[model samples]
Structure formats: C-alpha cells, structure tokens
Target: MLRTYKFRIEPTKEQREKINETLMYCRWLYNALLEQRITAYKRCGVSLTFYSQKKELPTLKKVCEEYKSVHSQVLQNVVERLDKTYQAFFRRLKQGEK
Candidate 1:
C-alpha cells in the first residue's frame, strides 16, 4: 500500500517564479534523458543502464542552478528521485523485465 501527503507554502512572486523555473528545467532534463534512453534501447535490444545515465547529473545540476540560483538544492532534491527511478528501471531491465 501507499500513502500521499499534501502541504502548502507561501512564496513571493520572485520565489514562485524561481521554483517554477527550476522545476520546469528539471522536468525537461529528466524527460530528455528518459527519451534518449528509450531511443537507445529501441535501437539496441539491450537497455542502457542507469549506472551510465548518471554521468549526466553534474551537468544537469548546473542547468538547475543556472536558472534558479539559490534554490538549486531544492531542485536537486526532486531530480534525485529521477536518479533512483532510473536505477530501479535498470535493475528491472537486467532482471528481464520492465
């Protein structure tokens, strides 16, 4: 079973803008990487491992920081989940599955 939680924060216009900007950039990077991985696997039956995909993170972190500046750590927190997700995907793939 799983659970969900919800919370709210009051952000100023500038802070809201920064958060949105950071999240958008994070989403773009995550999706592009996923798409690239998918394309690679389609071209070759063997899936590219997350262990390899992670080499891009330092660069991705730079993108996150460049847009939002002070909020980089918060943005990095979200992207980190994508990292773990990719790791799980590779583990499943190696086990002969999705």
Candidate 2:
C-alpha cells in the first residue's frame, strides 16, 4: 500500500523572483553542460560521464558566481537528469528504434 499527497500555494513576490532566478540558473547550467559533452565527444572521441561532470561543480561555481547561489543538490540533480536522458537516448538507439 502507498499514499501520495500534493499541495500548492501562492508564493510571495520575492519568493517568485527567487524561484525564477533559480530556474534561469538551472537552465543555463544544463545547456552549458550539454554543450561541453557534445564538444568533448566531437573533438576528442570521448564521452563525459556524470561523475566527471559532477567533479567540475566546484570549479564551475568558482568561475560563475551565480551558480554558487543554487543549492549543490539542485545542481547535482540537473546533471543527473541530463545523464539519465542521455542513457535513455542511447538505449533507444541501441534497440534500433529509428
């Protein structure tokens, strides 16, 4: 047996602004990471794994101050999501689902 619950509430104006900012940062990071992986593969014939990307977080934070504001767990989740997407895409390709 299992149960689930969901709740929604109106956020304050500042909270809304902060939420938007966080989303913007996450979107930027996702795109940047994707680009990095693509470029690495195209130039070096290598695939960047999640762990390798995750290890760069500290350096990224140092280079981009805005990223520091976003929680580490949230940043890691973004990487994890991208990795999962890549895995699923490859899996489908392997199955010859063109």
Candidate 3:
C-alpha cells in the first residue's frame, strides 16, 4: 500500500528569509555544477560523477562562503538532483527520445 499527503507551512518572517536564502543557494549550486560539468566535458571529454563532486564539498565550502550557510544534506541533495536529471537525460537519449 502507498499513501501521500500534502501540507502547508506558515513560517515567520525570519524563517521565510532563511528559506529564500536556501533556495537561492540551491539555484547557484546547480548552475555552478552544471557549468563545471559542461566545461570538463568540453575540455577533456570527462564527465564528473556525483561522488567526485560530493567529495569536493569541503573544498567548495572553503572557497565559497555562501555554501557555508546551507546544510550539508541540502547541498548533497542538490548534487543528487542534478545527477538524477543527467541520468534521466542520458537514458532518454539511449531510447532515442530526444
């Protein structure tokens, strides 16, 4: 059996601001990772794997202050989301869907 539920949250102004900031961080991380992957592939025909990127999180945090504000799990999930998207895209390509 399976079940699902949807709920709404009413956060305080401060919480709202934090939520917005997290979303912005997520957007930035996604764009940066995509660009890095594209550049890597173009430069040497190498695609970065999720684990490789995940392992760089500490170094990335040290280099980018904004990343420090977000939770580690949140950032990891962002990387995972991109990986899943790429996986789906390649799977579609193999199926001649694009």
Candidate 4:
C-alpha cells in the first residue's frame, strides 16, 4: 500500500495574489509549450521540440521575483520545484523514458 502526504502554506493577501499569478503563468506557459509541440508534430511529424521553451522561462522568473517581493517563500519554492520537475520530465522524454 502507498501513503499520501499533504502540506499547507500560509500567505498574506499580496503573497496570495502573487502565488495565484505564478500558477496562472505556469499553466499558460505549459499549455503554450504543449500546443506548440503538438502543432509542430502535426506539421512535421515528430520534429516538434521544446528548446524554445527556455526563451519563455524569463517570464516565469519575473513572476517568481514578484512573488518573492511579497516574501512568498512557499510559493517560490513550489515554483522552483515545479520548474525542476518539468526539466526532469523533458529529460526523460528526450531519453525515450516514460
């Protein structure tokens, strides 16, 4: 059997807004990246790639900085972890691993 773990974070109103913006930005970027890849695939048959995704990362960093301004450490950490996780996922995909 497996166990589940959960955590909670407390943030001020300003921090909360920043965190929300961060989530929105992440979702937007992720969807945009996926759509770009998919469209490329449909056009070129697997020639799609995410290298340009890095170019858009500055937007995420800007949002992170905004959140950090509000001392939203928890949100910042979550964003960092998510960024790392995406990198690992992309790496695994590159390696042909699910």
Candidate 5:
C-alpha cells in the first residue's frame, strides 16, 4: 500500500527570510554549475558529472561564505537534479523527440 500525508504551517518572518535566502543561494549555485558544465564542454569537450561538481562544494563553501548557510545535502540535491535533467534530455534526443 502507498500512503501520503500533507500538512501546512506558517513560518515566522525571520524564518521566511532565511528560507528565501536559501532558495536564492540554490538558484545561484544551479546557474553557476550549469554554466561551468557548458563552458567546460565547449572549451575542452569534457562533460561534467554530478559527482565531479558535488566534490567542489567544500571548496565553493570556502570561497563563498553564503553557500555555507545552505545545507550540504540540499546543494547536492541541486546537482543531482541537473544531472537527471541532462540524462533525460539526451535520452529524448536519442529517441528522436523534438
């Protein structure tokens, strides 16, 4: 059997601000990682993998203090999502889907 539950709650003003900040950081990281992958492939014909980019999180945190505010797992999840997107895109391309 499968089951699901849902609940909703209001966040305090400070909590809301913190959540928004984390989201902004995630968005920034996603865009930066995407650009890095595209540039690497264009310049050197190398495709960046999720594990490769995930390994850079610690160094990124060291260079950008803002990323430290976001949880490591959350950032890894962002990388994973992008990788999945790329995989699906290529799969569809191989299947001749427009």
Candidate 6:
C-alpha cells in the first residue's frame, strides 16, 4: 500500500530567508522559460519542450547567481510544472474554450 503524510513546521530566521530566496528563484525561472517558449513560437513557429528548457539550467546557473543557490531537481520540477501548464492551455484550445 501507498501512503502520504503532511506536516507543518516553523522555520528559523536563516532558513526562512533561504526558503524565500529559493521561491523567488523558482518564480523567476518559470517566468523566463514561459517567455522563451512564447517568443520561440511567435518568432520561429516552434514551441520549446521541457527537455530543451531543462538542458538550459546548467548554462543558466553559470551565468545567473539566483539559480546557483537552488537545487537542480527543484529547478527541473519548475520546468516540468510550466510544461504541464502549456499542455493544459493547448488542451483547452482544442476544446474550443477560447
């Protein structure tokens, strides 16, 4: 059988600072990837896939200090979440929602 559990705990001042910083990095990465995808499609008629964005992380970390503090898997998950959002958007388009 599979199970799940949830808990809430308070963070220390330093930990809270790190957590806030990580959240900001994640938000920035998501927005940047989304913009890349949009611009690629608009200018080149191509939509960027998750793997393409994921591959860019290493290079991004080298140039962007904000990404260096965040873990690799956390950044990968952000790319995946944005991909899911794009997929849902196209699905809605197919359904004639807008």
Question: lDDT of model 2 at residue 39?
Answer: 100
Candidate with better TM-score, 2 vs 3: 2
The candidate, 1 or 6, that scores higher on TM-score is 6
The candidate maximizing TM-score is 5
TM values, all candidates: 0.55, 0.92, 0.90, 0.47, 0.93, 0.90
TM-score of 5: 0.93
Q: Residues 15-41, candidate 2: write the lDDT tens digits.
A: 999999999999999999999999999
Instruction: Summarize candidate 4's per-residue lDDT along 1-98 as a digit string, tens digits.
Output: 99999989789999888778767755654565567666877988864333344554556557556433333344344445545666788899999998
| Candidate 2: C-alpha lDDT | 0.95
What's the alpha carbon RMSD for model 2?
1.7
Q: Give the clash total for candidate 5.
A: 0
Candidate achieving higher lDDT, 1 or 3: 3
lDDT value, candidate 4, whole model: 0.59
Better model by lDDT, 4 or 5? Answer: 5
lDDT (Cα, tens digit) per residue for candidate 5, span 1-98: 99999999899999999999999999999999999999999999999999999999999999999999899999999999999999999999999997
Worst 10 residues of 6 by lDDT: 60-69
The lDDT values for all models are 0.68, 0.95, 0.94, 0.59, 0.95, 0.94
Residue-wise C-alpha lDDT for candidate 1, range 1-98, written one tens digit per residue: 89999989899999889778767776776687678777987988766554565565666667655643535455455456666887887699999995
Error of 6 at 13 (Å): 0.6
**90 in model 1: Cα distance from truth in Å?**
9.2
Ranking of all candidate structures by their TM-score, best first:
5, 2, 3, 6, 1, 4
